[model samples]
Target: MSTVDLGDVDRFTVAALGPVGQRTFLLQCRSEQTVLTLKVEKQQVAVLAEYLGRLLRDLPRPGHLPEDLEVEEPVEPHWVVGTMGVSYDAELDRIVLIAEELVPEDEEGDAARFTVTREQAAAFAVRATRLVEAGRPPCPLCGGPIDPSGHACPRTNGHRPPTN
Candidate 1:
């Protein structure tokens, strides 16, 4: 088993590539010396963002906050995420993300454990919300996402229903 300890990470964020409904989501963590990108499910990203926001809101304020909130776009991912764990480190005064890599049987999987400041976590939540909301709008008839090419709304039964 391999482990990457991205101690006191400089930046962390979730991003999606390609068009909505056909997008590839990613979790990126960076330090001064290392940049790591991990492939993650879009749903996972959404859940994490919500959880992080709640966690930060509940915890007492940490004295120092990260000054900048910018996420960089990188070309490739180091690994695809299999499982994840999030917790607070009281001693370090940071939120920790433990991301395990997906690997084939007989191969040792890698795990990345990184810590981010409260401010960074909050910013990540905001960015993730925006990224998710920017996707395809919901269909009025069935409440499902409407693709650019239009959606076959179940409520309409493949017919052009009257639009209000």
Candidate 2:
């Protein structure tokens, strides 16, 4: 399969566009003149943040987190991610993120890989966590999103819908 290797990124971030519960999540990386953007799911962003945070906990503390973690526009995505993998490169003290494009099982999918400094990774995790949390609040009973109108919580057994 083809691959886009962004050896080291000047900036890397996850961003959500549009309103909460109706947002489009994106993963972006920029290295010099090259910029790569891929579409990702909301759950993917949440899990990535959690995994990155866990990974960083075992490594040396970041000296300084990146100041800017915004996703650069035009916001076009190269492909939608079907699967992703992340790992820490201890020797280089950097984090590697690999995203594979969504494709049919019989087809070969493209891949993008990038490396980020510990500082960038830390900043990314923090920013991503905040972004994911900024969405609609979850129902205490059913663990599903409580809409602006109301939530038909499964635990309610259709007796009453909770209004947020």
User: What's model 2's overall lDDT?
Assistant: 0.90
Write model 1 residue lDDT over 1-164, tens digit each, in one string. 89999888888877888877888888888999688988998778888999998898898864555545454756399889988999998888889899988888778899999999888888788888888788777787787778777777789898874332
**What stretches of model 1 exceed 4 Å from their correct place?**
61-73, 104-107, 138-144, 153-164
Cα-based TM-score, every candidate: 0.80, 0.94
**lDDT for 82 (candidate 1):** 84
lDDT of 2 by residue, 1-164 (tens): 89989998999988999988799999999999888989999889999999999999999899988888778876999899999999889898889999999999999999999999989888889999999999998888888998989988899996688877
Residue-level error in angstroms, candidate 1, position 145: 3.1
- The global C-alpha lDDT for each of the candidates, from Candidate 1 onward, is 0.83, 0.90
Residue pairs with backbone overlap in model 2: none
Distance from true location, Cα of 42 in model 1, Å: 1.3
**Cα error, candidate 1, residue 15 (Å):** 2.1
